[model samples]
Target: MNERRRGPVLIELEDGPDTDARQGPAEAPREPGPSPADAPAIDDPDGPLPRPRTMEMVTRLIGRPPSRLTRIFINSGVALFAFLLSIAALDFLNGLLNSYPLLGWIGIALFAVFTLAALGMAWREYRAWARFARIDAIQRRAGSALAEGSLDQARQATRDLLAIYHKRPEMEWAAKRLAEHQAEAVDAQSLLTMAETELMAQLDQEARREIEAAARTVAAATALIPLALADVAAALAANLRMIRRMAEIYGGRAGAVGGWRLARTVMTHLVATGAVAAGDDLIHTVAGGGVLAKLSRRFGEGVVNGALTARVGIAAMEVCRPLPFIAQPRPKVGNLVTRGLRGLFD
Candidate 1:
């Protein structure tokens, strides 16, 4: 019988006495038995292979799954709406073009212009939206981080976010305004504190309080003068005989004379303050009556030239001089409303 040979067979022939002697069998011949790691077991029988979806399918899968024929419905709906809108727009355009067939040309020209305008506007809007989106996301994340008690993260987010806005001119301006307002408030508070401290240091507490109280009273009184003048003007507006005429209404001798006298008082205040007025400015005066008559004479003009002229100077004086002193302005709705409603009756 011919000897038979098996192809690469291995037998455990009891590890013949010298098995551990020379070295491991030629690089530890790859095991013929299944490996523990590679054993075909459990539910898996094959290796992984790629069957990636197409781009469009991937988009739908990651976002909204397509129902095979469903996209047609959406596209059809959009197309219908777009077609209707285009038809309406075409009709409107056709109407214009119908007037002058050349209007279609004009419209095309205008359309080009408007298209450019729309493009520019869209570009601007997209830029603004992009900026705002970045800002909003950063602020949102900053708020979340703050809430999570990671102050450093919140601050970093805030600074990074605001950095872009601070680069804008309008934002920079607004920030500057806010800083100025805060500085002014701080200065005002500091001055008030200093004033109080000074007063307390210079005078007994009661005396200081009294002085402050008296100062406030004087300010309050002064504040009433402008209002008083306004009331006087309001009182006269209805009764002035020449309410219509108004050319150089204050040129009347009486008004000029009156203005002179008032000017004198202003000069006196200047003098008291150790200042002086020019000779011409203090040249003349009204022989009789105070500011009321003079100013009354000023507005005292009604549809008449002399009356208007005579009263103009004093009236102007009364209105302008006292304004700086007044803090609270009186409401004028009553007289204004009455005048407005008069039209109804008319």
Candidate 2:
């Protein structure tokens, strides 16, 4: 019986070997190994994510994480203390004024003068604000004309810009710069560079001076004013002045829309770069007890803000510049800070 089946068995073995050689034993049906979704989730293979909240950043800096209740209590205590201090300061001033009629009368007169001056300033600010729209319009028109490569239109735009500057002595530098290419048959980019160079070169010193002055003013106000809000108000005013001055210096005084846009952008830059908080940290580091501490903190804050302002001014320069700095090296923050700090202390 085995001899009779041998031929069939031999034939089956030969067919199996041929099938295995051709198809390689069919791969055992591959049990669908753990899917892609089942794999461990990975962090950004690129880099770390950004922190959104200021307080979150604060927690990281301080090392020890405080509970929500503790943070709330601390903030509440600070607010209460400031409020009580403000009330006491007001009461003290009132009692002093009551005791001294002459001094009170002098204070009244000074207050009236200040009120008038403030009104005058408000009127001037309004007028200046009005002029910004026209200024922005002129700049846009010129920029567009230049983009079209129309030399005549660019020259006309230059003339228009100069027309505004002719009456303002503060804009004499810009006027002079623009006057150079007012009639020249140059490309828009070249003309724009000349104006930027003239306007921005002088700004290194002027901007620092302005920021330092603003810092001093903030320090003085913080030292005298009992309310923390007063410090905020002073800083706001100072920033406005700094930005406005920068725009003017850069030969492109921004309109209300432009000013707001610029301010928003600059503030965003400060916050994003941690420049705003950096100033606070610097002040806190040098800060101690009493009036001197307050002044020091304010001063440090101002310096930090001023440095930020300088950065804003430099940014403004970039925004207003018609052409990129191909041949020249762009201004560096380190140099600006060094110069600004020197100017501030000096």
Candidate 3:
């Protein structure tokens, strides 16, 4: 009776096919790959490096990799030159032999010896130039590695760089520190920081002294000299020297291109911040009637310019050094200017 009273073919709509049983759980949407903008850009190591126009031309003339036809031409030219040299040398030797019996043999031997020596010297010079190029290239690679945050590669490059300083007592400490850093397993930033702290201490100190001296000189020139142009010229000269020294310290002995780059960097810094000329009392100095006031004004201007020059030097360091100021904060332009102004008055 209860079975007969059961609900008439009641379909359980809520209890239909279990989605989990039929289709299983819906798979999560696939994740997208990184966008092009998000992808990191790596510098191509085999790409052409920056060089002065003169250097580029010279490199093309001598060190450039030749094509098949170019190589054939070069070989042919070298062969022709060698053939001409042999003909000239043989003729001279023959003349000597005809003129004097004993002297002729000696002359022939001497000529051969001199020719061999000359060739050896030329080869060595060529090798030296090539070595310098290779060293610069390695430095460029190290710089790139540092930029990419590749510490191991940068450290290895630093160590290899020490090879250039062999037998140089002045750079002995740097060599030692580089060796020490290489011996230890450390991150690139740490190694660079330590190198900057310890190995670069002397260089930094020397740079500071140079900055101070330049500042004083420029200030003296500006204050003591009557002509505004003279003061400006003096400032320019001091700034240039400071920049060049800084570049050299940072292992970027400036070729024309490098010098131009450094100059542009300094000029850009000037344009962007006006950090160098911020605190100068140029009008008061120029208009002031009294000798003391004028002297003080000139001194102040010099100090300001020198301070700016120092800033340029610091910027040069950043430009020339492969590693950036990642581990430590770079000095602020405002802070530097303030300190410079204070020092000038004091």
Q: Which candidate number has the best lDDT?
A: 3
User: For residues 162-192, what per-residue lDDT tens digits would candidate 2 score against the true structure?
Assistant: 6665677776866676676555646766665
Model 2 TM-score on a 0 to 1 scale: 0.43
Model 1's number of clashes is 17
RMSD of 3: 24.2
Q: Give the residue spans of candidate 2 off by over 4 A.
A: 1-127, 145-147, 170-182, 197-205, 215-233, 247-306, 313-331
Instruction: Give the alpha-carbon lDDT of every model.
Output: 0.35, 0.54, 0.56
What C-alpha lDDT, on a 0 to 100 scale, does residue 181 get in candidate 2? 53
Q: In candidate 1, which residue ranges exceed 4 Å CA deviation?
A: 1-82, 85-102, 118-128, 149-152, 168-346
TM-score of each: 0.23, 0.43, 0.47
Tell me how many clashing residue pairs each candidate has: 17, 0, 2
- The 10 consecutive residues of candidate 2 with the worst lDDT sum are 49-58
lDDT per residue (tens digit) for residues 1-346 in model 3: 4565656686433333454465555566579988998776674334322211221222233223449998799899999999998899889889989988788899888988998997877665565445545555665766677678788776776665676554468888777766766657466656666655555555655655565555555556655678746666666666667666766664555544344445666556544665434344322322221233333544444444444455565655554444455444554434443444456668
lDDT against true structure, model 2? 0.54
List where candidate 3 sits over 4 angstroms from the true fold.
1-148, 252-262, 268-299, 326-346
**Higher-ranked by lDDT: 2 or 3:** 3
Q: List the residue pairs that clash in candidate 3.
A: 219-302, 223-298
Candidate 1: residue 228 lDDT (0-100) = 40
RMSD of 1: 40.3
> In angstroms, how far off is 152's CA in candidate 3?
3.4
